[model samples]
Target: MNSNHLLLEEPIRMASILEPSRPSYFPSMTKIVGTLGPKSRSVEVISRCLMAGMSVARFDFTWGDAEFHQETLENLKLAIKKTKKLCAVMLDTTGPELLVVNKSDQPIPLEADSFVVLTPDQEKEASSNLLPINFSGLAKAVKSGDTIFLGQYLFTGSETTSVWLEVSEVKGDDVVCLIKNSAVLAGTLYTLHVSQVHIDLPTLNDKDKEVISTWGVKNNVDFLSLSHTRSGQDIREAREYLSKLGDLSQTQIFAKIENVEGLVNFDEILQEADGIILARGNLGIDLPPEKVFLFQKAAVYKCNMAGKPAVVTRVVDSMTDNLRPTRAEATDVANAVLDGADAILLGAETMRGLYPVESISIVGKICGESEKVYNQDSYFKKTVKYVGEPMSHMESIASSAVFNFKIT
Candidate 1:
């Protein structure tokens, strides 16, 4: 994070404004989710989002501490009151994950073909250019052909600009990786994802459990989205914990399909969870970029047939910097509506972007427009009716049948 990163100092609320003269924004079957962060954490911005077309406000536990998120939650409650509109608050739990730390106190920009050492310790070995990772068993886990990503970007940042490291040698705990791609490592913590390696870690960390039992239970959050969901057991474990706390029924579980491991176990996870979020950022790192669109189509189609809420994330990523999105980004949101997504989530685009309200309004308009023209009896829906089994990761989008997707 940059020292100059924007943060809201005080709360300033604005009235919920909806002009009847203009065409109404009744979100078509699909919902819109906006992440609550520094840029959009204010009462006015939240009200703007709700008025613009947001149905759910998400509090990401990955970036901020408990205190920070609690404040956001309180503000969201106020926003809900001001708008007097029905909305859900999603407590996004940071499930089993890994973060790459550069302890050198500065940018460690690596050129292409540079060597970096991966260690599983908090040792200050910045002099040796060691990137400290939290989890263990790294050296023996990844092979030479594995790829690594730099950031945990949900949307906006260039996937090609994201740095990737390829393992070339493994020497005990010091696994040496070669930088296959180069970029300026801007922050202290650079998130990493190893290619072809399934991270064997617990579903929930101690902090996650602590939050669920206290703040989550107290707030009765509408949705609990588990990150890096690997299997059905993970969903069951989270539900068990919530049940123990008497919050299981109150909070609907949303499984995030982030990694290859999650995709391998998608059928079971989807069967156990209440909803699905096709988290495209991590999925891009998990699978090839060429296959991401296919996965999105398959995910939305399956969730629709099952009658579960399917959310398409990372739709307007380009809104992070500019007020207007590129043509491709706009098309992505329209296609998500055509794909029959139950919701579309804004990550960095809303969390840290300059045009949070504009992003939501643009996607909302597109969703409404696309829905008007979407055919009810399509070949894809016929194919979906024909096949009872789940589709593959690379399933063709051309035949992905859009089902009756609704948001309540």
Candidate 2:
């Protein structure tokens, strides 16, 4: 080859070695979604996440009470205004599931095949079958043959049960149930439904609603992510609440698909929601563990068919807590990108992990690489149909600019 050709060939060879050899699923431009928790709610942390390419910040409303939520909302608004970053806030709600907490203040170990009792107490306690769970509606939701999870242990239900245990006999404040043979993280158990699971209902509890409503009005948050969404009515309730404060017409709402009934009523929910979030963590509890993957794929396809943006949330990298993500996890994330997710959510990874920055960097790298070889345009067009339609009309002008630049 000529000397000039040899130089070009060298660059190509270097690139091939430095990057994946085969076609990838990365996109030229990808949107990023992040979760905001204790570690990431501050102005500094918020700036870091945004600088790292976070386009959206998911604010989980489940952890604290109304007062706590108000404080967080205010802090978030101040940070956004100070930084002048173009990031969106996503307000998430806890549905009817009984969310449990480890009184031990850390990850608790549960022996395999051990009998444990769970109760409705907030204090974590030691027991075979009794642990404290908080959802008042939990008794109504769980049926027999349902599996409870605490870490990875699975407890088969002898029958549909809500056997109330004596509060005095309960040793600790909480008991972990291994549900459906899935890895039980810090969560509670409950039956999943798509028809809006009403617990506290549409009204914000006490004065907290006023605080959140104020933030909503001031920031004009880009999206509201409703957790534990059961039906289109849930969407309506949330919308109605937001409407009372202000227009909220520009804001979009996302229905979290994390339950059996939610999946069943997915079509109706989509019609009401501006988008949908595939919350696999809780969905695993609602359905058979093995079916989570199928359900996820189905949800994605359904969302795509409906032309709504779908975000894949939860445990995108759960194992990252102890060690680096396994190859399986990497491939799992890449596969989701290929599946045409508008955004992949980083929950614990960014919220409480050691390698938060690395996590986002890895995601960005993987997504960027994957788009090079993947039919990204096809996926984007199919998924973001609304956005794509407008862009298509403007494509000609952009194409002409490119042609002129090429000539010059």
Candidate 3:
């Protein structure tokens, strides 16, 4: 072990060990699904999102009509082609449910202490003071002490589990009464139509069905998000509809588990559905807000064990509406990724945020960091050399030796 000989051999050892492998694999990018909306639907805007690392674009079926969706799909496809990226499209269906108000021309405002009754009546206006929701047994479900929260505020009122209230407030067309303590939620996008009803079949509404068919025919859509899906039957019905429209090949189904029924029948739903989307906006209304975190972890693990992609969404914060996401918002996204979600969806963050591009960029950065932390061990393991199949064969040994460059 002379000093000169040791120094000379150290350089040779370093050169052999540090050489790159012939076929190296890198960690895959976590899919980012950006919702398509008026402000974000133009060619330039869509392109910017994709350039910023969006892998999928979601078009909510609840928003526009078939013709409008057709136009959006056309524009999205053109953008994908122009950018040379294989971005997928998702068409989210609105079940046979009803939101309190029609699409607003401007953002709706909800004041503190307001009483709103939700009934089956769509004509029920703000003055009705009665927020008529379309689900049965709704008024009966409201217990004496339940805190119902709308967009970001809580509503307070009486004993019947079916009805909720907080008397005192100015109301325009704001999305009303985010009810708490219900098995199934009412009033948000994908709110349950037959929450307490005895409906037996998949409740695909006419308007939503038409949009699903159009998006299916367009063939650009990559996923069909079944909202308010309560069972395996719902997934089956949606699949049949997609098949009818000739979209069975590549387009997949993602069942949104936002209710008690969906949570209970998860195994059945997963069998029929391609993936699961944890829609917490309405889901939190059904379960305890604290429980949502536990449930989210369980859902992520369940989907992972089943080898299905799961997406956690509704990371609503002041930033989603204002300029930046709160710390809680950041933690929510990071936890989902660490729990093994294949994707993280951006809703209002992209739909109506002041900085939609910035929102998505921040989301990407979080996702990138989470992936790095979660996959670090796997990254190193993949670098270790291993023999391939048919290890006993001489030729295979020679191939490995040559490929590894272990022998000159």
lDDT of 3 by residue, 1-408 (tens): 787787686523445435543221132367888887776777888777777777888887665667776777678788898877678878887774444443222333333344345455566453324444444444444443444443321111111213333323223332234333332223333223323333343457777776666556656577888888889998888788777776555678899987777888988998888999998866766676788888888888777766689998876445455666788878777777888888988876776555667777777776766665575344223333332344457756765775677335
Model 1: which ten-residue window has the lowest total lDDT? 8-17
Q: Predict model 1's lDDT versus the native.
A: 0.78
Where does candidate 3 stray beyond 4 Å? 1-28, 102-119, 123-125, 132-201, 375-408
Deviation in angstroms for 63 in model 2? 1.4
In TM-score terms, which candidate is top?
Answer: 1
**C-alpha TM-scores of all predictions:** 0.85, 0.70, 0.71
lDDT, residue 60, model 1 = 85
Candidate 1 residue pairs in backbone clash: 380-401, 381-401
Query: Model 1: per-residue lDDT, tens digit, 183-225?
Result: 6665665567775577777778888888878778878899998
Candidate 1 Cα outliers beyond 4 Å, as residue runs? 1-24, 103-105, 125-128, 152-156, 159-161, 377-408
lDDT of each: 0.78, 0.60, 0.63
Clash number for candidate 3? 20
RMSD in angstroms, all models?
A: 11.5, 8.0, 9.6
Model 2 misplaced regions, further than 4 Å: 1-28, 65-85, 101-114, 121-129, 150-211, 318-323, 376-408
lDDT of 1 at 284: 79
